[model samples]
Target: MLFNLSRPPTALRRSTSEFLQLCRQLPSARRALYVTSRSKTMSEPKVISVEGLSSSEANVSGSLRNAPRVHPPALMASVAILALLRSESNKFPPSTIIIEQYRPPVDRHVVGLISEGESPEQTAIRELEEETGFKASGVVQSSPLLVSDPGMTNANMKLVTVDVPFPENLEMPAQKLDPGEFIQVRIVELAKLRAELQAYERKGFVIDAKLDHLASGFELAEKLRQPKSST
Candidate 1:
């Protein structure tokens, strides 16, 4: 389900400051207002009191104030694809692609968000193809919904890994990026994932904690894939 904020009511719009003050007096009322606004699309504007919002919500509100519109969901959910492309000829080791894109209220960064009504695997395939022009064959692993930023937004992200086959000398497909979406797909060796993440951090990009955790899990999986030696 998606929650959206529309324009404010006439009375609420008349005095934004007064509405906020009232919100501070009644937290339940504030939540109720949000519930109503999000339940259905509002043709007329719906006002919300920022005073009653949590710190994270307040921050988001502040960021959107200058913008002409704001539409935030009540419970945000996203999916990240850990795509692995391997050469069929074994000429090259398997590598994965991570995206660099611009995120709202923040500078350019590395992350991807799943679209609504799409399953994690479907999101994985769609995002992979759109962002990197590679189609995933199947999902190898999937993570439960993990909190992205508990303090700020109630958004959660699920991570999934899918296998991508790239035969030798095959031409890559063209990427289909969304409008205003500036994405750079960087392919890195599986073993050098940590170093690549660190490099991104050094460049002043806020690395998503979920990505770090997912990378750790991938590292463990790689280690486990190694054949056990006879004692």
Candidate 2:
């Protein structure tokens, strides 16, 4: 006796025929078809329903349910410039850094985002000049990218340090700010950064984590620069 294999349903056959016709239009479709066929052949049949499953299988299902879900694209690239500006004063230090006080959508804070088609260093230089009206020499240090908040976002920040020269006779340029931006550039002493940050925090301004890290880095660098006294 001869036996015939069951044929696929008409709808499935039609769908397959249409898919094949569409695939024929593309050159790489044959490779895709081969991969799909191989995958399907290698894959084991999975029982989706929890009913009548073994304890191990049920546990596996539960684990799958608790698995971290892959979120959509919410990652963003940001830049924070720790700008050092020259001060022409004998009493005070010869240089002071600039930090901005700006409001974000959630709260009044300080941070900056890098623009498209611009490097981190470029973004820092541009933002520093735009916010403070000072053109400065910039250097992109070998610093690791920091995650703003690992739990909430995949956003990473690039911290850049820019040094600006302010000679007594040097002309200051006009600030080029965006229409919606309301930024106040404050000259901050590196030694008094903690106090300054505290003062800002008292005024309902939320400090960006990147700024805190940058400040800490500055302090550490200063400490390293201090000469050790010989015993």
Q: Highest lDDT among the candidates is held by which one?
A: 1
Return the TM-score for candidate 1, rounded to 2 decimals.
0.57
Question: lDDT of each structure?
Answer: 0.56, 0.50
Off by over 4 Å in 2: 1-76, 87-102, 106-112, 140-142, 168-173, 217-231
- Stretches of model 1 off by over 4 angstroms after superposition: 1-76, 106-117, 169-171, 217-231
Per-residue alpha-carbon lDDT of candidate 2 for residues 1-231, written as tens digits (9 for 90 to 100): 000111122222224346446445645312122111111231422211122222356446432221111231233366666666555643345344444432212211233555567777887777777766877676736256776555443446666766766545334466676643344455666677767777866754566665566567767998899999999
lDDT of candidate 1 vs native?
A: 0.56
How many backbone clashes can be found in candidate 2? 0
TM-score of 2: 0.53
lDDT per residue for candidate 1 within 1-231, as digits (tens), equals 011111232222323355435545654213223111114454643322122232356446433222111333333355667777788998678777766543333221123554577677787777777767878889999877677545444446666778888777334677886544444556777778777778867755656665676568778998899999999
lDDT of 1 at 50: 26
Point out the worst 10-residue segment of candidate 1 by lDDT. Answer: 1-10
Evaluated with TM-score, which candidate comes out highest? 1
